[model samples]
Target chain A: MIELQQINRIFTVGDQQVHALDHVDLSIQSGEYLSIMGPSGSGKSTLLNIIGLLDRPTSGTYLLEQHNVTSMNDDTLAHTRRNKIGFVFQFFQLLPRLTALENVELPMVLEGIPPAERRQAATETLNTMGLGERLHHRPDQLSGGQRQRVAIARATIMKPAVILADEPTGNLDRHSGKDVIELLEQLNKTNMTLIIVTHDPEIGLRATRQIRMVDGRVMEDNHKR
Target chain B: MNTPDFIRLTLTAITAHRLRTALTVLGISIGIAAVVLLTSIGEGIHRFVLSEFTQFGTTIIGINPGKATTAGGSIGVFGTERPLTIDDALALQRIPNVQAVVPVVQGNAEVEAKGRGRRTTVYGVTSGFPEAFRFDTAIGKFLPADDPQAPRALAVLGDKLRTELFGNENPMGQRIRIGGDRYRVVGAMQPKGQILGFDLDDTVYIPTRRAMQMFNRESLMEIDVMYREGTAEKIIVKDIKRILQARHGKEDFTITTQQQMLDVLSSVLNILTFAVGALGGISLLVGAVGIATIMTMAVRERTAEIGLLRALGAHQKQVLTLFLGEAVVLAAIGGFVGLAIGVLGAQLLHMALPAMPVHTPWIYVVFAEALAISIGLLAGVLPARHAAAMDPVTALRAE
Candidate 1:
């Protein structure tokens, strides 16, 4: 479960203050599959970043599992991000120096998991993502589809309560993008809360719940299932 | 991260740019090698000088005529001081712990033997000269003990002088003219090599009284007293001063213990070694600069990696440690290589030129290694700090 009360994110560009998120309020129950659809500069990605704890809101009272996460320190926020949420970026920000398995094992490595156990888990996760043969390949050596799959494997390896995907298929072909969306939907079917921020209406329609934003405010919220 | 993982991470980073890493390592190694080689030679020379000075035996004391105190005016401003006499040498023999005393007078003289003539140093010393100065005869006996005030016409040829004048012929019974005085050669000294630039083997020795006459000087040049090994120098010096003062009614002689001379010599040699080492340290400073430059570049190039590590939950200290580890490892490897090369080179030099001493003290080796490592750590500080302080979001976005 997540809740945001009067969340506001403001950025100062030279002389003007841009309201990226303006007095926004929203709530979502556990295991709900939601998609945030909006045009450029509509605060969709900004909202996702705030939920992922990668960027702090200028003013917010964000509650996750009834705990006010907005007041936590940087280190505490990092720990929470590591344990409670996972992020899949549009550019697939996998470390180029590491192999696919190593990329997936990174979150567990940060959690201080034993090497043998983390390796085994990473191998299994890569295999389940249809990348068993590409386990030792670096991101540069893999195809776009395989790289996105590796990113997805890495995101879900920690089994976080919420998976925030900000245009996960933005850089992939239509077929790979469809496969990535299906993989995310499969995870959501297993009772994981999945939130996607994208401009694709097809991917937006596949979500059980959809929210549309315009000019930094949530304008429409619909539950389809 | 575990230690092995952390080290591997650093190793991977370094190995990624092999040429750069090798060049940096080479810089440090060259610096360490220079330090080790120069210090080894410096230490070797230090020991060599000390041994050469001590070869005459450290238990002896030389009493030179005239007080060493500087007068108000220039040279000869102070009227001729009383010279140390044979009686003064005899008086010193009466002191406790005194084993032997040799009243010495020295001058350059032309000596003729078997129609060959050469000008060389001539020493006028009593029979106790050999014992007091640790000199030994090669083929014949040293000078016989004769009266200090009156002795027979006898001469002892140094090894080199005997070869020059006698040409391997038995010179024991031969007559040699020293300063126009014909004296029978009684003995030939063994080869004692040079000490402080004076060739001991290129001189001749004669009786002190005859030598005083030959040199046309009434004052003995110096009176050397050899004391027992266990006796303290202070006690022996005190006794010598007392009797000489009693006889002359004042202290007109300066007594120099071997220990005092050696202390001065060793201190000067220590300074020489330290100066040489410091010169070598300049090269090491250059090496450190090289490391700093490389590390700065590495930090700039790996901004994204640093950001990724932070995103993976590595603490700022961990990032700092990773970069610092790479630098230290580079320095340590370079230092080890340099030490090996330097020590080997010194040994080879010692073999090639046996006269030039080449000793590598272990303490200097360890010190050089520690210095190299510290240089690396210091050089890594600024760059590592920059890497550690980078914002994860901004760093990840770097191209």
Candidate 2:
């Protein structure tokens, strides 16, 4: 479960203030398949970032499992992000220097898990994502669809309770996009709360609940189940 | 991370850019080499000066009247009419630690043997002059011991001076004129060589009785004495000073021992070594700047990697240690290499010049290398801190 109240983020660009997020309030129940749809400057990505604890709200309260994560130190925030949230980026921001297996095992490495156990767990996760044959390949060597799968494997390697995907298939071909979407949806069915931000109405229609944002404000929250 | 993994990662990173690491290490090594070479030069000069000084005998001491303590090393003033006397030499022998003291009455004079005339120094001294001046003869001996009543017409020529005056003919038992006085060459001197600008070989030795009589007036301008073993020269000097103060009723004479001469030499070498070492330190500083610049560029290039590590949960301290690890490794490797080079260089230099010994003192070499490493590590700190302080979001955004 996640909740955000009265979130407002303002940025100064050479004496002009741009309101990136304005008084936004939202909540999501556990295990829900949610989609946030918006145009370029509509605060969709900012909302995802705030919920994932990657960026701070200028003025607001954020509760993840009813704990106020507002004044947490950088280290604590990183730990919470590592343990509770999984993120899938549109561009597949996989570390280029590491193999797909190593990339997936990165979070475990940061957690100070023992190497043998970390490798064993990461191998199982990659195999479940159907990247068993491509485990040793780097991101640059894999196909667009394969790279996104590796990123997804890394995201869920720690078995976080929530998955926040920002355009998970924006850079993939249609067929590969469908495959990534189905895999994400399957994880959602298994009771891991999934929040996907996309501009496509077809993708938006796949979610149980759909939210539309316009000009830094929530324009609509429609039940599509 | 465990230390082994940290070390492995550090080594891998450094080896990733082999040429850059090598160049950086070379810079530091050169700085260490500069330190070694400069100190070696100092040691060589010290050895050379010490050898030349020891050649003139250890126990021998000289005293000269102050010539207003002038600019060019205390030059004797022109027309300084005072000369030393036989009574002064006798009086010095009476003091404790005065082992065979001698006084010289000196002047420039011409010598003629078989119409071969050469200008040479004429010195009238006591019998102890031969041993005190470290004379080694090729032919004959020195004058007999000075008897205040018996005036001997004796002369001793330098080894070179003998050949110049007598050629194949023996100069012993021959007579040569010293200005207005004729003296027989009782024994040709063994060469005493040169000592601190004084050409002892070119001078003739005669009895102290004859010198005072020949030089006409003698008020004892100087006195020379040798000290007993285990008794410090300063003690003898104090006793002589006390006796002289009582006899002359004034503390006008200067007293300095052979140890004082050596102390002055050591201090002079110390100052010279310090100056050369300071100059060498400048080169070391330049090397440190090179390391700092390289680290800065490395930080800039690895900015994305830093972000990735941070996003993976690496704390700022870990990032800082990563960079610092690289720097310390570079410095330590450079120090070891430079030490080897510097020491070997000193040895080869010593071999190339057998007459001059340039020691590679480990204390100076090890100390300088240690300082260089510390400086290099310090140079890396600012860049490492800057790299660690970069925000993960902004760095990742930089892509």
Candidate 3:
């Protein structure tokens, strides 16, 4: 679970000061599938980054399971982020030099997990993601769908509590996009917090909870049965 | 990382850019070669001079008429006025370590043959001069000891002077005119070519008695003495000076020994060798610059890879060490290869030019190698810092 109270984020470009997030307050229970919809410059990505702790708010409080992580040092924040948070970006950010298996195993290696266990866990994770046979293929050598699949497999390797996917299907064809969203939804069904940032209305409508933003403030936060 | 794995990684990365790595290493090789070649020349000349000087009879000491300061700033052979006499020679021969005493008188004279004439410097020496010089005559016997008494008008020609003035004729008992006198050739000096390009084979030697008589000098101006080996030349010089002071009642003569000659030769060589080594250091400087530039480019090129590694939780220190490792590896390899090449190159040069001995100072080569590697490591430091200092977020944001 996560809580936010009057969170605000500001950015300055040259002489003009811009408020990216303004007095935002929100809450998400565990296992919630949330889609944040916004027009260009709508502060959806900024809000997601703050929630993911990749960016800090200019003011106000953010409580992730009652931990006020805003004041934590970089090392402590990194440790918390590594253990509990995973990110699936629009570009699929898999290292081009590494094969699918190696990329999936990266988070475990970063956690200082032993080699044998890391490889074995990475293998099982890949098999569950239907990429066992394609484990040795590098990102460039794989299809867009396959790379996204490998990215998703990597993002979940640490069994993180939260998954933030910012336009994960942005670069995929429609069929692959459908498969990626459906797979994320499956993870959400298993009590994993899933927050998808996107501009697609059709994709936004399928979420159990939807928040729409325009300019810098939230326009709507609607929960659907 | 463990040392073996780190070494393997460095090797793999270098091998990935084989051409660039080889070129960088070649830069260091040239620096090493320059040092080796220059030092060899210096050492070769030194050894040649030393060997020749030793061969010309080191036990002999010459008292020249002029003040003799060393070529370098070591001993000052300071005295003037041609202050020696035959009485000094006679007194010096009575010293404890004294073996032979010879007085030499000399001048330049023109001798002619078939309308061809060349001026050659001639030495006027006693029969004792040949004994002091340890020269063996091959063609004819040395002049008798009674020559100083009867004062025979006979001469001994050097190998080159013999060929020049006689042209294959047995000039023995034949007359050649020089210095207002016609002297018969008594014996020829054995062949000894040159010392540091100074011709040893052009001089003509005649009896010192005849020389003093011709030059119209009643006393000896230069006294040459020979001493027994393992006897301190200084002690013998002291003995001669003591006897001379007692006889002439004045301390005004100078003595030179073989050890002094060797010292002068060493100092001359050290300067030349140091200059050459310094010049080669400039090339090594260029090689260091090469390493810095290459490391900078490598860091710039690997920006994304660095971001990727940081994303994998590599610390800033680890990233810095990786780049530093690459540089250190490059330098260490270059140093090892350069040392081998430099030493072998010096030896090969010696073989190629047998007349010029190419002396390889292994200590110097080792020092150069150590410096080169240190330069390599130092050169990489800044670039490695740049790579390590990059912000992962910003780097990832950069295309």
**Candidate with best TM-score:** 1
Candidate 3, which segments miss by more than 4 Å at Cα?
Answer: A1-12, A18-89, A92-139, A145-168, A174-225, B4-62, B66-82, B89-104, B109-120, B124-157, B162-190, B205-211, B217-269, B276-290, B328-360
Q: iRMSD per model?
A: 2.2, 2.3, 3.7
lDDT of 2: 0.79
Q: TM-score per model for chain B alone?
A: 0.94, 0.81, 0.80
Error of 1 at B354 (Å): 4.5
Q: Candidate 2: lDDT of A165?
A: 92
The 10-residue segment of model 3 chain A with minimum total lDDT is A73-82
Task: State the lDDT of candidate 1 residue by residue for A27-54, as single tens digits.
Answer: 9999999999999999998898788777
Of the candidates numbered 1 and 3, which has the greater lDDT value?
1
Clashing pairs in 2: B136-B190, B137-B190
Error at B52, model 1, angstroms: 2.6
Write candidate 3's Cα lDDT for A76-171 as tens digits: 666677678778878788876567987888777666677688889999988988888998988989999999999899888888889999899999
> Could you arrange the candidates by TM-score from highest to lowest?
1, 2, 3
What count of clashes does model 3 give? 1
| Candidate 1 Cα errors over 4 Å, as ranges | A63-71, A108-112, A156-159, A189-192, B70-81, B228-231, B348-355
Candidate 1: residue A159 Cα off by (Å): 4.2
lDDT of 3: 0.78
lDDT of 2 by residue, B1-399 (tens): 667657766776788789999998888887778887788788778766776776645665554443333345434543342333455456667876666677766777777778878888877676776666455566777777747547678777887788788777888788788766788887877666676787777877776667667777455445667655577766677776676656555544566566778778978987887788777778788878888998999889888777656655677787898898888888777777777788788888878988666866668877977887797789899999998898876665565
TM-score of each: 0.89, 0.74, 0.70
Clashing pairs in 1: none
Instruction: Judging by DockQ, tell me the better candidate of 2 and 3.
Output: 2
